[model samples]
Target: MEDEKNRTGPLMIALQYNDLFDLDSISASTNTEDALPKGRAVAFVKAVQTVNERLVEQNKSESLLFEVILIAKECSEEIKMKIVESVKYYGLEIGKFFFFKKEELINTLQSNKVKLFLSTDRDDVCEALHTGIPAALLYEQSDDHVLSQLKVIFSGDVIGFSEDSLDSLSDFGFSETQIETLKAAKICMKEFAVLIGQMKRRFGQENSPLCICVLTAWGSTNVCVSALKTLREWGLDVDEAFCLAGAPCSPILAVIKPHIIWDGGLHNMRDLSAHS
Candidate 1:
């Protein structure tokens, strides 16, 4: 069946592995044994439905793969069963859902060829990234946004730009000399870039359901220009680019309401999540 789908066309085929969401991202944190999927559960369901619908509209037979992985220190059978039931109730169609220990996560992810891993927990995200997985810390959304359109925002630092340059840019104080030095630094493609490239390849750049945006802290300075040029040099062009120049991103984020935001540090995610 997979082979048949691949034969349809380049854009019509499914990605080998797409998104993997941690249980915490979909569920509410609680002390109870049966913590059913909550918070972003509905949004996740909508995202899957939208992606499948878009694929069908383009005359594709395969659906975008969405997996829900649970990594627990100790998860009983009853709790696991309850989680399965809750996922069904929420109508979140998962391609592969399983529970694993912390030690088993890297191997599991490798064997499955998971492209992008997302979790609301900082530690889980950090672990995945540390193991060389394309991972991002997802923030919980309470407001209504366009779930059909999966909007993802990435910081310049997350894209593997110069750290020192980004720090200066965020401070709203960067001279031409600093900007030139940043541009001189050899910036290689990071895991996040690889994920973006995969998406672009799977759906074609113009037809992809993803609305990729770059929300850089450089604002509108020359440093911002250099950073953007670096992104292009790395073969990435996002749908939207924001040069905030050290301003609060809450207002801009509230307007865009991206489904996920990727940054270089957990602190960045925490700060954005707090303000968003």
Candidate 2:
């Protein structure tokens, strides 16, 4: 990629994708990149995620980072010949930080040039980026349930169960502390939504630029869901809320959604809660 492609925004690094489901798009091959038997969705998603980490490390610089994936696996298998070229992304970052280390990660992205990184070794990639070198990683996103949850959260969509209230969502796996923060944020989100509504009435209907809170982890679902509903009811484009959350059960939590996806920052939630 060119130096300009690596440029950055005031608080964001640029991310570019060559293919939505193209594996060859990335230099890393079969072993490193996630491969799919019937769907290129996994590979495409992995490449996009790798690009995200790089963007975080690049931060506001004039550097643009491009992450590509090889997605023609199934087509090749069918015809017994390769048909390269396919990739996609939900590009853009800095909507919200729900995870603690994410700030550290973003801090790393701001100064260094992380060329690419994979989502599979998320913890490991994050560790390597500490050196301030442009890097890359790959990952795949599947599992409809988790993806659904992520999609809803990233889109700022409300996750409402048929039950009026969840007796316990421990199946999602979250620490007690995270749950508490989600609860408080949930209540606050209701008020926040009302303010957002008033903003819409004053400014007219357009959410190109809006401040939002993100919640990560199942522990955060209660408050996060409440907040989302409130925003929708009050009339803020909640899908544009740009909140954050961190629960590492599934690979692609919120990315499948339309909103700008963020890695949730639960441990980091303290700083935000303290301020509130």
Candidate 3:
């Protein structure tokens, strides 16, 4: 009884349905090997329900509450409804089963209710980890291993799991040429980190926050945006935000005054008052 009391509670699992089930060519007439079958979907739902039932039978429901969240992106509402109905048939309560779109995912994952995130998308896993959520990747190899890995995520042993190479630009839906352009224009994370450190050291205590001018091409826009979010996260007050057209030699410039500037791209920390 004491050992049972010390056991970990049930994990709240957020499953990205697109990863677990194939939706590449889901259509009424298109029944290919890659298409997710209705029978398989039902079986998956029932398997999860069985786990919950076993916990309840052992009187461990209070210690652990198994919940499943389904996230569907680029799928029709009809598909979403069908999936939801299938899960409901397996005795999954309305509150325990949730469906969300790509846009709604961040907020849902940030919620304290979700304990672990499971996805096949590398970007999704990264997003979850960035927001301080534990995430695991679902592969088609083995169900037993995947289930065990989910528990590992809940235990906080693994923060993110993805075997795929991460192409941020591509994952964000940029075309092949655009991805190459973005890769060339984008500032590396190390450079961004250094810039953030410089900001914290320089204008971190200024009465008026420093204004940032982000000048970059369209392909590198995400880099600038991520930089802004990172700045805010560091508790720095960003006075103004501007996106300039054309790619400047320097990706990020700090406008200390009308004339004074700090160039992050060059790592130039000198007072530019002489040039002004």
TM-scores of all predicted structures: 0.64, 0.27, 0.42
The residue-by-residue lDDT of candidate 3 on 55-148, one tens digit each, is 4654644454456666666566766765565445444442444465668787877673565565545566655544545553332332332221
Ranking 1 against 3 by lDDT, winner: 1
lDDT of 2 by residue, 246-270 (tens): 3342444334332222222232333
What is each predicted model's overall lDDT from 0 to 1? 0.52, 0.33, 0.40
Please rank every candidate by TM-score, starting with the best: 1, 3, 2
Against the true structure, whose TM-score is highest?
1
Candidate 2 lDDT at 257 equals 34
Per-residue lDDT of model 1, residues 134-213, tens digit only: 65546566425436567777765334345553454434444444443333322213434533444444576675776777
Name the 10 consecutive residues with the lowest summed lDDT in model 1.
9-18
Off by over 4 Å in 3: 1-10, 28-48, 60-63, 88-101, 142-276
Candidate 1 backbone collisions, by pair: 219-243, 219-245
